[model samples]
Target: MSIVRYLTHPQVQIDPDVPVPQWGLSPIGRARTEALAQASWLARTTQVISSGERKAIETAEIIAIRLGIMIEIREAMHENDRSATGFLKPAEFEQVADQFFAEPHLSVRGWERAIDAQARIVREAEAVLARNRPGDILFVGHGGVGTLLFCHTAGCPIDRVHDQPAGGGNLFAFARDGRQVVHGWRRMEEVAA
Candidate 1:
């Protein structure tokens, strides 16, 4: 069966001065993405796409280079627009994130509504899959919307309980045709072909 993988960019360099969308991967994050490139399953990816944000793009670029492939960037694949609050410290961000998942229908501190972000991510992913019939497709993006998409594909409720673990660099797999989740979130290195 055709399979699609969605991966969240690994940890990022937290630069309060830099726009959150512009912040690239941290040194450790780059190392993590590079290490993930060695996964056997990544070699099978025929199409690679990423959110327009820097971190996601950086992560996608690393994998693409390893596989000798090109990356397609999609703005709709961006993390839920937390631009309302800009960059919050990790501690504060977690609190806001908790509320975001808890109330999917409501805007958390003027951030993009969870429901809205889910819709956008789902729509973009569907459109991408419709146009590409690759044997294996990979989407590199953020954790928030990734969890939302994962919930939609898995036929689960939009809840943070479905979210990936505390760090980034996690992934989920689904059947491209049926859109059924084949696997839950796991670190990139943990995935097998």
Candidate 2:
């Protein structure tokens, strides 16, 4: 059976003053994504969808162009809403993220609860899959919500242990029909056709 792949955008240009959603891909991120476009596995993707966030959109665009497919942006595919806290430094963000995963029910420092984000992601993903024709699909979004969705599909609990590696550019595949995760997170370049 074919698979649905969820990819997290790679490294982004960190501008402390900018809103997290507006931040785009960094130089290294662009380079890495361009390289990832060369992966043979990407040829299998017939449709590309992305979160409205700039970083994810940028990543999706790169892949879409390489695969000669148009991108469909979905607002619900966005990262866990962190607007309440704004841009926390990496160290501070990591601390809060740990809490977010540890207590899936509670909003850590005004961030969206992990369970809520998980529900939104799963719902949005299901909607996308239901409406589209059967084929390999690629969903480009953020790591936090991606992990939550992966946890759901894998029959695992919401935990950072299931999160993608730091710095992003990771993906996991799931069987399209039954929604069973075929594998854990792997770097984009590492996935085969």
Candidate 3:
């Protein structure tokens, strides 16, 4: 059966001055993505989908290039919107993210509610899957929404407990036919294994 993998971009440049979505991947992130691009398992990836955000685009571009495929950008697959507060310090961002997941129904600090994000990501994934394309699919995007998607696919409630690890470059896989999760939050480098 074909599979779908959602990969969160790795470490970013982390500029507080830049809008979060505009921040590109850091050197480490790029290197890790390049390495993942060569994974044998990705040989079957016919469609590479990504969020419009810069970092995610960068990540998708690397793999799509290696797979000899063009990427399809889905803006609705973007991370839980946090533009309301702009950039926050690492500690502060963590606290707010915690609350964001903890209270899925409530919008924390003007951010998009977790429930809303979950629905949007799920809807976007379903739209693509409805096409019933051949070969595996790769979705390059953010950790927050990736986690939200994972939770939904795994039949779990919205919670940060399922969040990807820090520094990103994590991935999870699910069966496209039944939308059932095959794995959860493996580091990108280890996906081939």
Q: Estimate the TM-score of every prediction.
A: 0.97, 0.97, 0.98
TM-score between model 2 and native? 0.97
For model 3, residues 1-193, the per-residue Cα lDDT tens digits are: 9999999999888888889999999999999999999899998899999999999999999999998899999999999999999999889989999999999999998999999999999999889999999999999999999999999999999889899988899999999988888899999877763
* Candidate 1 off by > 4 Å: none
- 1 against 3, candidate with superior TM-score: 3
Q: Write the per-residue lDDT of candidate 2 for residues 1-193, one digit (tens) a residue.
A: 8789999999999998999999999999999999998888777789899999999999999989999889999999999999999998888989999999999999998999999999999999999889758679999999999999999999999999999998899999999989888889998877877
Q: Give the per-residue lDDT digits (tens) of candidate 1, residues 1-193.
A: 7889999999999989999999999999999999999888777788899999999999999999999999999998999999899989888999999999999999999999999999999999999999867579999999999999999999999999999987799999999888888999998878877
* Per-residue lDDT value at 78 in model 3: 92
> For every model in order, what is the number of clashing pairs?
0, 0, 0
Ranking by lDDT: 1, 2, 3
Residue 170, candidate 1: how far off, in angstroms? 0.2
Clash pairs, model 2 backbone: none
Q: In order, what lDDT does every prediction score?
A: 0.93, 0.93, 0.92
- In candidate 2, stretches whose alpha carbon ends up further than 4 angstroms from where it belongs are none
